[model samples]
Target chain A: MLKIEGLRAGYGAAEVLRGVSLSAEPGEITVLMGRNGAGKTTLMKAIMGLVKTSGRIELDGTDLAALPPHQVPRQGVGYVPQGRRLFAELSVAENLEMGLGAGPAQGRAATREEMLELFPRLRERLHQRAGTLSGGEQQMLATARALCLKPKLLLLDEPTEGLQPSMIGAIRQVMVTMRDRGLAVLLVEQRIEAVLELADRVSVIEMGRNAEDFSRAALSGAEGRLRARLGV
Target chain B: MDFGPYLMLAMLEGAVLAAVLALMASGLSLVFGVMRVVNVAHGEFYMLGAVVAWAVTTLLGAGPVLNFVAALIVAPLVVGAMAAAADMVILKRLNYDPERTIVATIGLLYILQQLTLMTYGADARPVVAPFNERIALPWVEWGDKGLSFYFPWGLSTTSYKLFVIAAAVVLIAALKLFMAKTRAGLIMRATQGDREMATAFGVPVERVYALVFGGGAALAALAGVLIVPIQQAHYLMGGDALLLSFIVVIIGGLGSLSGTIVAAILIGLSDGIISVFFTPTLAKMIATLAVALVLVFRPQGLFGGTSR
Candidate 1:
């Protein structure tokens, strides 16, 4: 489980996240929806210690706020940043190896065979440069790489952005599989339908603060109100 | 005097020079490629290597072979430690900003140069070679009865010079293998490819940067140690080494390993051959002119990809 309270973060002289608090539990997907520039990315980044922040970010009761970005992964937090951010020149296998370099959780990481089985297309392009992958394949590779950490809590920032419908479905299945496997997922997404289908709970972010929190079952009747709040 | 023998001798000498240049320039390129920071103080590390070698040899009071062997192992380690400390103390504090690092290294260059001068003095010092046996070189000539091998007078090289070339080749190969096959190298390459992603993956990038800075300094020091026997250790020696390394790096492509080696060979061979046949100044002039033309026409360099 991951918890954050009174999290305030921003770049120099300009605060983007103001007193936001949220929690994500195991075996569930916590979908965070927000309008453009509502600070969804900054929230994820702050949790990963990529940005300076004042807050109590706890993963299984250990503080992550004081740690550096590199140390955050060691706390069982795997981040799939926006844009995939794959090592463009590195091979897919090498990229997976890089994920392992972060010191996998419990000295255990997903093996190449496991990753290949999960994303069969990756096995065929094992030696191909990650940059050369198609948009869909790159997204899959990014998820596979994060999975290599065998992380307790995975943070995904818009994993389906710019993806085709088939690729979106594939990603949806991956998220569902992770959730069922008892992994905690904190996902920042814009796809309301996918969120309704996949998320166990939803939190809407409004202008750097948590606006609402409700069960995914409540989303069906509350779609219009949620859309009005999201301004989507 | 037959010109063929002289040309052959020039080429042998050029190869030796090329070996040393390749080691030095490759280190420079690797550091730039990984850190994206131009190390103006790199030459000072080379100078320190020679100084350390001199001190080690003198303190051990051993035979030429033993002394050289000890110095070879000790000099790079000491310089590498010093560089790592410098990286942590200064470069890291500056956050490795490109312009700030450049300025920091420039300051470090003078500081190191002055420290060496104050401690070691300004005198040029010689380090005796481990072995200096003369090997007569034979050349094949077409005679009345097919081809015959003959040793032309004065056409010979010292065993130590050949050893320097061999050592360089072996060490360079080892470095390449280490970079390609080692886990540390994988982390370094990952960091080079994408710093943010590497950090997110828990690479401890600061440690990698320190290792790389130290490794690059160690390489330059190793080259200095190997060449100190031929070229006396001097306080001002790093100036030319730095200039020549920059030339090779620029010509080969700023961050390319293979490009650095190729450019080093090209420049080193030309420097040696032209110096033998013509003048060293002319060789240098021609090299400078060539670099200018390369910059004007193909600024990315001969082997460089699109500028990083």
Candidate 2:
């Protein structure tokens, strides 16, 4: 249900996502693979309306190009940015409340409850200040906060970075459950195997242009070739 | 034969007086906390409240209870609305320029004082007690040979000054609770903590500025109401309180409510005690010097908890 056409974005003078294009369908995990500075995060931020973006960005035939950051959630976009930028001093509960915004839509708290059930460890520390939480716990809190917005498309940036294997497994299960629940996910992570394992389709980018778009099954057997391309 | 009674009486008077000063300073402190705007017109708000109460009671034939309560409630709310109007007329146009806003408010201060003088004529308008009776405080006889001290009991016990103290304590407590408990209070705190982040949260920051200014004006108005009973509701009442409130805020730590209360009490007691022994002018001079010295040593005042 998400689409991007000729998306061009940058911070200031230096252009990052140079006329890139990609899309994720309903109930599917679309993995975006790229190097450290290859504009993966830029594309996600552009979609969330957090960064300056030009060209076409739409979901279900509606443009969200000029919407403010706070309005992005109402337009069916949920973002979990790198570093899990949770409001540091606020408690997990308050942080979650903030994600709910001033809008009067129902099920915001119920969605949080569902995320807590999925990440049951968060259920215990529901009232703890987010700054006091461990790295994995903070990531979960950030992810859980975004999910509470109840968006149709979720953009996750580096969800596995600096996280333990168990947490990564939990995130994978969450993604699968959410996909089955008909929530489209645009997954950005460094873990090639984990991403490939979950994504229904994969799109690789090099220097802001799409290098390849292939089904997850096609990339499964060509692991050696991809490792050679990555030179790792 | 004993000076103990005189000293005790002086101490009691000082506390009563200090409570009045503390109330004014707390209002100034709250305004500074969130908006970071130093409202020079704060004392004018207080004076106007006192003057308005004085006039309303005397002219309308209202009793002290009704007059006093009405004064407290009406004056601040009116002044707060005036401040809100000022926001639309003047401050809103200034766009957070502290130097400009200060000049504008200080200008408003002078204009208010002048207008009050022009209308009320330079006489000290007298406000009477509810019942025309002089009650004497129980006299503490200390010396022999008919050399005795009379601490007046009747008026002193229910002095408008004491009433102001009770009101001040209640007002401050209510404000404290309102700031901590409400949703709007959360928005205010967040704005004070980090304005941009709060704005990003979709809080209208301009509304915050207006509310803060209104709150400050309301406080000054309360101080005005407190002073109406004991002091004459003269136009110049604002001047003395205004300068003193500035020193109180600085001594208390900028934008700290608790600090303002403590510092105000300290300064008021010092002002009263020093005034008893010395001329009022000299007492103010010494108090200013003392505050300067303390601030030199501890720049953030005693409670040093600024919002930032």
All candidates: DockQ: 0.80, 0.21
lDDT of 2 by residue, A1-232 (tens): 7889999999878898888889999899998887778899989878867678899888888787766655566776667778877766567776666556633378766766777787788888878877789998988887877777677888889887898898877777877888898999999977768865887988878888887777868888766665654455
Candidate 1 residues B1-308, lDDT tens each?
Answer: 37999988888888888898899888899899899989999999888888889899999989999999999999999999999999999999998899999999999999999999999999999898999999999999998999998999989999999998899889888888887778887888888888878888888888999989999999999999998999989988888899889989999999888788889899989988998999989988988888998899989789988875
| Candidate 1: residue A89 lDDT (0-100) | 79
DockQ, candidate 2, comes to 0.21
Candidate 2 per-residue C-alpha lDDT over B60-143 given as tens digits, one digit per residue, 9 for 90 to 100: 677666766676677888888887778667887987677898999988898878988898767777666443343345665646
- What interface RMSD does candidate 2 have? 3.8
At residue A176, give the lDDT of candidate 1: 89
The fnat score for candidate 1 comes to 0.90
By DockQ, the best candidate is 1
Candidate 1: which pairs clash? Answer: none
TM-score of each: 0.96, 0.71
